[model samples]
Target: MMRSHRLFLIAMVAILATVLFRVPAKADYYGEPAELVDRATSVYKGFLADPNLEWFRNNVGSARGILIVPQMLRGGFIIGGSGGRGLLVAQDAATNKWSSPAFYSMGSVSVGFQIGADVSEIILLIMTDRGLDAMLSTDYKIGADVAIAAGPIGGSAKAQTADILAFGRSQGAYGGVSLEGAAISPLVDWNARYYGQPVQIFDILINQKWNNRQADSLRQLLPKPRRNAQPLGR
Candidate 1:
């Protein structure tokens, strides 16, 4: 009887330990910024590899900033939500150089006829100062703060003169994808973790605060700003 009781107690403790260990930590919820940067690099490379994205490649040179969401998940039975984390990089008008990435989270809730889920890679080209300014804010709504248009696909496609242009590469059959009411907010914790200190969006992007060697490769992937061309919204 004594032996059986001891065995039962041991099993209970073992089960409890397993359960506790399986639970993810809070930091795990937000991925490491370095890993996110590498993933963003791959996502951008994938975009460039797509023959249908020639228009994007051509017009990207004119963008004031670029936001890359490597993997955004969306699903719903009726009332659904979509959310994801991404990196945003801006171009310095004076020096024609790209800035360090600013981390952000985007989420939205919708009520409609939606059933299935889809995973997609999203890219937003900030076409004007207005669009870039809105993204630099602490929190901003997509369509309300800055106008967003679906990016044109294919070689001969021409993008419209909008504040922002959005492109998506979906993995599953989602009926439709929209950024109409989505909210974008800065991820301060992730930025702090990456930079080893608390930093503001303006400090990292505009003022050029800390620098990480890991970002050198990623910065090289961006389109170089034209020296003769004037900055947008000048």
Candidate 2:
């Protein structure tokens, strides 16, 4: 009887130890990193196919980089703030190869926000080196750190000098939306999640230290790299 009791206790302890020491499951692998890129890809395709975006389609090839925000929710929710997740990728100057996409938190808080709500898809063309530099840093504001002008709509619209150009489409009660004064902050954790390791903003965007095959299709959708990424009049 004593021997049997000891054996049963040992078995229970072993089972408990096994349960306590087990390796847990990995984090949600298909979370923001994969899902956001997929959405951005769809938005990019939609923008390219839109007949109203003639200027965008024609001049995008010259951009140094592009920031695509699939859907930015703006309106009266609680108060004074609105934003969405976005991904940014830059073209290497020498190789002209597109870098891995890096996630960014984009939005602005304003006392002037209207009462109605809207969802806006925005793409910002980083037309100059300064604009690209701002994107690699910790944070940058649309109108403050870089000058931004709305991309002209028609095919005949000529390119002008600006640090960045904004292209957007909005659906809701609000008439339209402007990206001016919007702040962009790097989503470093998303990069780590997507790449399977933590990396710096510069490493992801400029140094090109990280690569994820998941983002390959999205990178391929980018406009062909142009020799000159600078603005025309600048």
Listed per model in order, the count of residue pairs whose N, CA or C atoms clash below 3 Å is 0, 0
For model 1, state the Cα shift of residue 134 in Å: 0.3
Q: Rate the local accuracy (lDDT) of all candidates.
A: 0.78, 0.75
Question: What does candidate 1 score on TM?
Answer: 0.82
Model 1, 59-119: lDDT tens digits are 7878888999887767655455677889998888777788889899887777786666666
- Candidate 2 wrongly placed segments (more than 4 Å): 1-31, 172-177, 226-230
lDDT of 2: 0.75
lDDT of 2 at 32: 65
Least lDDT summed over 10 consecutive residues: which range in candidate 1? 19-28
